[model samples]
Target chain A: MRLLSFILGRAAVALLTILVIVTAAFFLTRLAPGGPFDAEVDLDPLVRANLERTYGLDQPIGIQYRRYLGALAAGDLGPSTTYPDRGVSELIADGLPVSLRIGLAALAIATAAGMAAGIFAARNRNRPVDALVMGVASLGVALPAFVVAPFLTLLFGIYLSWLPVAGWGDGSLRHWVLPVVSLALPQVAAIARLTRGAMLETLSADFVRTARAKGLPERRVISAHVLPAAVLPVVSYLGPAIAGVLTGSVIVEQIFALPGLGRFFVQGAINRDYGLVLGIVILYASALILLNLLVDLAYGWLDPRTRTGR
Target chain B: MLLEVSGLRVAYPARGGEVAVVRGVDLAVAPGECLGIVGESGSGKSQTMLAILGLAGPGARVSGSAIFAGEELVGMPQSRLQGLRGDRIGLVFQDSITGLTPHMRIGDQLAEVLVVHRGASPGAARAEALQMLEVLQIPEPAYRLGQYPHELSGGMRQRVMIAMALLCRPALLIADEPTTALDTTVQAAILRSFAKLKAHAGTALVLISHDLGVVAGLADRVAVMYAGRIVESAPAEQLFATPRHPYTKGLLASMPRLDGPPGGPLPAIEGQPPDPAAVADTGCAFAPRCGIARPACMADLPQPAAVGPAHRVACHAVEPA
Candidate 1:
């Protein structure tokens, strides 16, 4: 019953947070230097006025916000100013699947590879293997996705011609290789460091000593006792790490020319496509809040001490 | 003898060289016997047992012979020792809070021993765990089985730890300062449980504590350790009545007595324990602190010499019998 209430409380806070983000995005985008139609050079003043009136941009800020909120409540994101013919929701439908496929895949790979490396390094601490894993993890963290993307393209695409340089072609596994890897690299590095530090600390914990004294095999001692405690810090880290990956995909999507939400987000922002931009912002904010809630729930499941209301 | 340790030494690597913590020590425990080892902190009483059990930390250099049930344990491979520990031998630590895994339920942790050693089914393990808790006189055994370590009180957790250790019915049980972290009432209760365990199971016990009163209650034989060596060893009654070593006598005098004057400062042993790294190679480590330190006490280390039947002491001032 307590856990249920805790989850409900978090969800309510999440909704409030998303609402604040949406309100901020709505006002901030309007406050930027130019109107969405300002780029339409040579257009007659009367035509521009007609265009603003049609999109409800000519209305006062209060009326426009109320109208947008009404439409948002009804699940209508309005027509995209940049695309003219496409609805913001329609554009999202086209792009969100591609973004989710790459994002989820990258997160999965990062979590698996990073935790494995971290556990290995912690177990073989102060040895050559430990040094080697940490050295590579350092390199992974140092090189950003933008830098690693182009470098990987140069190595695998230009020199060896082993994989496709860009684009989400045929929605196939091969198309996922470059972008997913570039996205996962820094995340893997961050998680590896987090896991390694937590694992090392947990390895020396008194309970771990008790586990060892129980005559448990080294394997059981690590997996059953140490891993559950050690993974806690890493689990807490994942919420922000996921947000970073999702937002940071903007650069990756632009470079690779993928039809993902990140590309739409960037293009929408550049053209001041208010509806499209607002829709994507709200989506990302809501997703992040939900993900953080899930992380908290996972933490409680793993550690009973956190279950009781504090 | 169920277990015999001779010249048991444990040293750790230091800047210049290795520093010995448990200098060459010898002791034994027979079937159904209780051997109490008493000392101040850092006297290496705990390290001696840890080394004997092969639970000493990494970088520790442990040497000498520890034979348990006709098998040598000093250099036994870890895989073999794993089988012996928690099966033929049990161990309990001081801090009940940290000694148990906080996340694990009491039943699962208790059942884990049976699962690991006996290869019993989970159902069977759970049943046995419940029985052990009831045997230990824990209230609401069924309810406790579902509770995590944090939910239990300190004494309850210590009881759980003891239950886990004894689940496999080991021939020997070693409890190191088991009641130091508990209140006096709780401490008495835990001591009573240990006495009960010894009587019922016929398990040889090695109880390590700094409190002489605690050991005096349960130990059949007592060994007083000072500066990593057994300074005195005798039958419990004899050792309490006529503690030969000055250090042992000092330790006895320091204990608070119920019949003493109502409001007075309790007697205490003065001076800090000698640093393991700086201990002199020759001379008794306690010689500098001894009230009767002689020139000869500083010149050479005194070996434990027999004074009475089953009694030995290692102080130059004591005349050998």
Candidate 2:
């Protein structure tokens, strides 16, 4: 009953937040000055007005919002004015999986490599090994995806004759490497720094002292007692880190010519495709809320203090 | 002796140079005997104990010999020391709040010591943990096994710590200020269990605390510490009755007396304890704060000299018996 209540409460809040996000996104995109057909030269004014009427852009802002919400209630995302042949829902369906694939890959790389480096630095603290790990993390954080992308592409794609430079592969591991690394490097550095700080604090806690006094080996003590407490901050940071990675992937996707949500969202914003832009915002917002919820649930499992109604 | 520590020292680095917190201290615990180590905070009573087990934090430099069952413990490898810890020599820390992992179930924490050291199957280890909790007289022992550390009260948590240490039936148990934070009633109950365990298991104990009253209830012999050194040591009764060292006298006088005036101001020691880094290398560490300090007291470091049978005091003020 307690768990159910907690879940219900979180779900209600998530719904309210997503509703607000959709409302604000709707108004902002509509208020922007431009039409989807403005980019096309030699278009007749009558044809443009006819296209705007078809996509409901000719209606008042309030009426369009009500219509959009009504359609959303019926599980419809409306049609893209720029991509007249494709509905917003269809565009999302096609684009989401690609973005999710790259985003998840980057997340995995960040978590594994960052956590390992953090743990290593904490264990060998104040040593040469500690300096080396922190140095690499600093470099990773300092270099953005745009700056690192070209260099990585130059080194691997052109110079070394390894890995593809541009365009998405047909799910090939080699093609996925550079983009995933570029997308994840900054986040990996951030996670590593957070983990290292948390790990240092956890290692010095009295419980960790007791764990050592219990005669458990150092490895068992770290894995069993220290890691859980240390990983908590890292888990909390993951929600925002994931959001930044996905949104940041817009530039990454454009540079690599990848068929992901980033590409569509950017193009939609440039063309002033209100439906497409609002639809992508809603998707990203929903993903962020769900990921944070998952992180909270994981926190409850990792720490008993946060367990609902315990 | 079940365990004997000779010239044990613990030092750590400071901004200027290395300073010894525990300077060449010596101690011994006989089989099934409870040896209480009494001192003020920063007197290195805890550090001395930690050094014996090789559990001192990084940058701490330990020397001298801790002979346990005829084996030197001071220079032992961590792998060897780990084998002895929780198996042959158990340790219980002061603060029950952080002694056990907050995220772990009580039974798992108890059983882990057995599983790791004795190679007991999980089933056997768990059964033994339950039995040990019952032995410690933890109410609803079976129910508590499933609960996390935070769910239990402070006294209950301390009992769990003791139970974990005693589960393996170790030859020696080092409890550093085990009952310091507990109320008198809870302290009594914990002491009763400690005495009972020692009687049944023949487990020698090193009970480190600043509370003389708590130590009086459980210790066979009491060692009084002052500024990282043992100032005096004797049978508990004798030490209380005829405390020779001035520091020991001060500690006893500071304790609230039941037979005295009902409402009198409790006495406190004057001057602050010296920081480890500020300790002088030439003379007694407590000489600065000593009430009966003479020119002789400052000339050289006082060594533990015999005062009576099995009684020794490190003070220039105490003449040879």
Candidate 3:
């Protein structure tokens, strides 16, 4: 019962957060120095005014916001200024699946590989293996996706010819290798460091000593007693880390020529496509808020002390 | 003897060299006997037990011979020690709050000892855990089974700890300052539980504590330690009646008494215990703080000399019986 209320409370806060973000994005987009039609150099003023009137841009900001919110309430994201024939929702439908495929795959790989590496390093602490894992994690954090993407392409694509240089070919496993790895690398590095530090601290806790004194095998001690507490920091970190991976896929999508939401987000922002931009921002904000709620719920499950308000 | 430890020394690496914590200690506990080791913090009373159990943290250089049930423990393989630790020898620590895994339910933590050591099925282990909790007289034992460590009070948690340790019916149970972190009332309750445990289990016990009054009630034999060495050891009644070493005498005098004048200043030991790092090689470590110290007390380390039946004192001022 307490868990249900806790979840409800977090979900309510999440909705409020998304609403604030959408409101801020709506005004901030208008506050920027240009409009969607500003790039047309040879367009007549009369045509520009007609275009603005057709898209409701000619109306006062308050009326436009009310109209947008009303359309949003009815599940209409309006027509995209850049893609004249396509609605913002339709564009999102085309891009979201591709983005989700990459994002989910990268998240899985990062969480699993990062935790494994972190545990390995912690187990072999102060040894050569620990130094080596930490050194590579440092490099992963230091290098950006753009730099690492091309470098991987040079080594794995050009030099060895083991994989394709670019493009999503039928969205197969081979197609996912480069984009997913590049997106996941930095998050993996961050998680590894977090898990390693947490694991080290948890290993030295008094309960761990109690577990040892209980005559538990070392493996059982670590797996049952240490891992649960150690993974808490990693779980909390996953909320932001996932958001980062999703947004960071922008450059990877562009470089790999994939039809992901990140590509639409960047193109939408560049062309001042307000409908497309607002739609994508709302989606990202809602997803982030929902993910944070899930993380909180996960915390309640892992640590019972947080189950109630006491 | 259920457990015998001699020449037990535990040292840790420091900047210049190693600093010895438990220096050439000797202790023994017979089957079903309760031996109380009393000393202030850093007196090496706890370290001696930890080193014997191989629970001292990494990089500790433990050199000694500890025989438990005729098996050598000082250099026992970790795998063998793992087998003996909870199955044959149980351990309870001071801080009950941190001594239990915060995330684990009380029943699960208790059940785990039996499951790991005895290969008991989960259902059976849990049933046994509930029984153990009932044995410890935990209020609402069934309700406590589902609760986390943080949900329980400090004394309740300590009781859970004791229950968890005794779940396997180990031959010896070593409780290290089990009641130190509790209130006076709670401490009394825990002591009462320990007394009940002794009467019921017939398990040998090594109770380590800093408070003399704590050990006064339960311990059959009491060993007073100072500056990493045993200064005096005797039957509990005899030691309380006539404490030979000046350090032991000072420790007795410092304890708060109920019959004394209210708010009157308690007699405190004059000087601080010697720092483990700076303890000189050739001298009694407590000589500087000893009121009856002789010149010889500062010249050579005094070995334990028999003063009475099963009583030993390591002071230059005490004559051998």
DockQ of each: 0.79, 0.79, 0.85
Q: Write model 2 residue lDDT over A1-310, tens digit each, in one string.
A: 8877888999999999999999988888867887687875868889878887888878998998999999998989999977889999999998888789889999999999999999989988999988988998999999889998889999999999888988876867786788888999999998888889999999989988888888999889999999988999999899989887977788888888888899999999999998899899989988989898889888889999778555
Per-model chain A TM: 0.97, 0.97, 0.96
Q: Please give the range of 10 consecutive residues that has the lowest summed lDDT in model 2 chain A.
A: A34-43
Candidate 1 CAPRI classification by DockQ: medium
Per-residue CA lDDT of model 2 for B95-123, tens digit only, reads 65777898889988888899999899989
Model 1 chain B: which ten-residue window has the lowest total lDDT? B94-103
Q: What does candidate 1's lDDT look like per residue over A16-101, in tens digits?
A: 88779989999999999887887857678999999999999999999999999999989899989999999999999999999999
C-alpha DockQ for predicted model 2: 0.79
CA shift of B215, model 1, Å: 0.5
A225: Cα error in model 3, Å? 1.2
Candidate 3: clashing pairs of residues = none
Which has the higher lDDT value, candidate number 1 or candidate number 2? 1
**Model 1, residue B312: displacement in angstroms?**
0.9
RMSD to truth, every model? 1.3, 1.3, 1.7
Model 3: lDDT equals 0.91
Query: Which residue runs of candidate 2 sit more than 4 Å off their true CA positions?
Result: A40-42
